[model samples]
Target: MFEPVIAPSGTLLGLLQRGRGDGTLHALAAPRAAALTALNQCVLHDPRHDWQVENRSLYYARLFLDLGGGLEDIEAHLFGPGDDPDADETRTGLALSVLGHLASYGRDDALALLRGYAATGANWAWALDELALRDDDAGLRSLAGAVLGRFPATREGDAALAAAVRDAFEPRPWRLWAEDRRVSVGGRVRAARESGSFDRWQRQMRPTGPRPDWSVQSVFDWAQRGADGGSALHVPAARCLGAVAGPDDRPLIVETARSGPDGARCAALHYLAEAGDPAVLDLVETAVADSSRTVADAAVAAFERMCGEAAVDRARGWVHRPDALGASAAGVLACRGGGQDEELVLGALRETVRADGPDAPLLWALADGAGRLGIGCAAPVLRHIYRETSSSQLRGRTARALAATDPSFATGFAVECLWDCEETTREVAALHAETRDARVAERLRRLAADPAEEAEVQTAVRSRIVPQSPPF
Candidate 1:
């Protein structure tokens, strides 16, 4: 997949791409044509940095409803010349999902579009999953012939069918077809279902990897062999060392950490760090400077896993080092440090944003630390990350942090957060947003009534709104 180019945070298109609630508010107030153009672009292009995890379909679908948009753009994109439905799900998954939400909201055009795409689209399975949730029995039953026809009666086709049945995100459509009396789909589907189940069981029964009783040296050798084969097994191998290594093995383990082969040294560092061996910290410092980046990374990871006071004390001393170890030390303090470390955590948060920009991975832990430590002055930088970071998950974390540190949160970001793509952000809004705003109360009612809203969000909404009186 190609990397998405996000617009500047100030632009309407950029806000929409970020799935910010403000995008929806802005789109509703802007010229309908301009808003629809930007909205359509986002849906068709799939702007999420990580499509599999970040949410956008619901956010977009609601905007479409408010804008009174048609499905013409979506249909054109799905079936346009040069577009391959089966090429990659990411290309069409967001559009299909938006149509699914529209169908649930009682849009006949959306439902019909989904049905048409499921019959002939390359990403038919995604459409079929959407139909499974909203379509009635007859609607799904009608799809049996078009869908099943894709798999021929040949051996390879049957195998393909079995795999589809095995991995389907929704089984309702398949189950309905299995019970259909009008076609041969029943027997074939039943066989596929059985085959899929047996295949799953067989996979479970297959054994791989080293057994639990292997000696420490044997485990190290296995890890080295795996490294040679292009798979890193040192992590699990380090666990094996925990089971096999006794006091007598300590000297050997320490020596391995000091000068053994790359794989063994990595494993020994992890094991020794977990054991909190007195000599491990010095060894970790050396490994961080090792010629091998792999060993250096392993050493940093091993040190981060240490939870003892010794590790925290070491983290304070190493936090200023201008290397990967220093970065890891900042993360450790962010997660486990006390009030004394607040300034250091804030400094790291500032430096990471300045050095790597708002989307830097290190900002995740530092953002959390800013909130946890109640660093009030970090609010501006947190706000910067919240607005410019393309990651929805990271943005949500920033929202939580802002709630703790920003005094203006309840009336500012909180109001717009009610429309955020992430439920966690909406829950935060529900708990803290100023209900005096007309939009906040209206959204809270809709969320309270919408069956699809998450349980946590609804619970938060209930806390703010009085219970409705039953009909007299």
Candidate 2:
């Protein structure tokens, strides 16, 4: 029976009484505060229903997402989206109390809400910890866990819960017998796969038959993650990258190369180079067409790396030499260089050396490669950027390039660069001090003595002036 005299206004916790297995105990329709009071009074009458509790547990979990709500909100006002008067928190207890239900009940609504909380980008321990506690459903857990795992800064939140979740779901040696949906158990499965503990792989994961397609899907998916990918979903995904792309596996090597990230692309390229196959050349050759700069860079780098010196010349030819795109392509080829292509490298370097040169737009693609690949051949261009570049950053960069290839100091170029009044030019000159070539030391001595020099230039040269060994 309803108690009208005792019932209050506002919020949905007032008219409630005892609920039970019949799913009809939650009749209150007032504010959460009043609902808790009435529910408390009715608690002495009967217990809450499991099904009703399940739904209410989810609704209370939703309230936790309030911009400024907490446990007190759920304690009094919590109710689910069902018609049952059986909505009760008396057993599930409080806000933190419902986490077990959300993860354990296979509740999509609860999981969805948890993801919404993560969308805030600020630290949300309650949401992450709830997920960390997840024990099954690899697809569901990965969708949430991978995102959270990327932000290690939040690991401190709900430490116990997070650890329990991490430990429970770590990568394992997978031998999924798709006869029935089931998850095998072992605390060390992930460890064995990660550490390349071959003994364990042989001991625990020899395939009983050809693995199901579902199992290899994660491995292929991970390949798409590019460099920052890893998984325990299937047998191939479980194998180490180096082994999977070995010489015999040209298709696998090329497939991984097309995926994301510089490092993975490089790895795949290196493997394919050794695999000695031309099958992936089209993918690598066309990589320049990719919209992502990083992917394009990787693709070019892979072509150069896998295809070697000949690939560099081909990529250079493909580089449209009119604008930044041409200069960039030339630069990549320039770095890995074949001296026979000296004429082309010089032509591009000459274009980059103009007073109106586009050096500042991309020094990485320009002078750096010239200094590395064309040091003997590209020295004049390097010296030109070192001397004529208006940007201090480019000047400093050129100096590093000259040093990288162990420059031929006999060219007297280091002296000219260091003597330039620009502090950046002088900084480039100072690096030649390591040339330990006496002429370089002489140039530095002259620099350190020039009191009229800009303070940065003076400091740079003095630092490189060979200390007590300076004749100046």
- Which candidate has the top score in lDDT? 1
lDDT of 1 by residue, 1-472 (tens): 7899999889999999999998999999999999999999999999999988898998999899999999899999887774684477888899999999999999999999999999988889999999999999999999888998999988999999999999999999999988976557888898899999999998889866455346888888988877788778888989989988999999999999999898889999999999999999999999998999989999999999999989988999998898999999999999899999999999999999999999988888999999999999899999999989988889999999999999999999999999999989999999999999999999999999987788999999999997779999
Q: Write the per-residue lDDT of candidate 2 for residues 57-137, one digit (tens) a residue.
A: 333322223111223333233233321334432322323335434445454555554454433322233444455455344
Predicted structure with the largest TM-score when compared to the true one: 1
lDDT (Cα, 0-100) at 358 in candidate 2: 32
Residue 2 displacement (Å), model 1: 0.5
- Superposition error at 155 for model 1 (Å): 1.3
Instruction: Give the lDDT of residue 448 in candidate 1.
Output: 96
lDDT of each: 0.92, 0.45
lDDT of 2 at 394: 55
lDDT of 1 at 146: 92
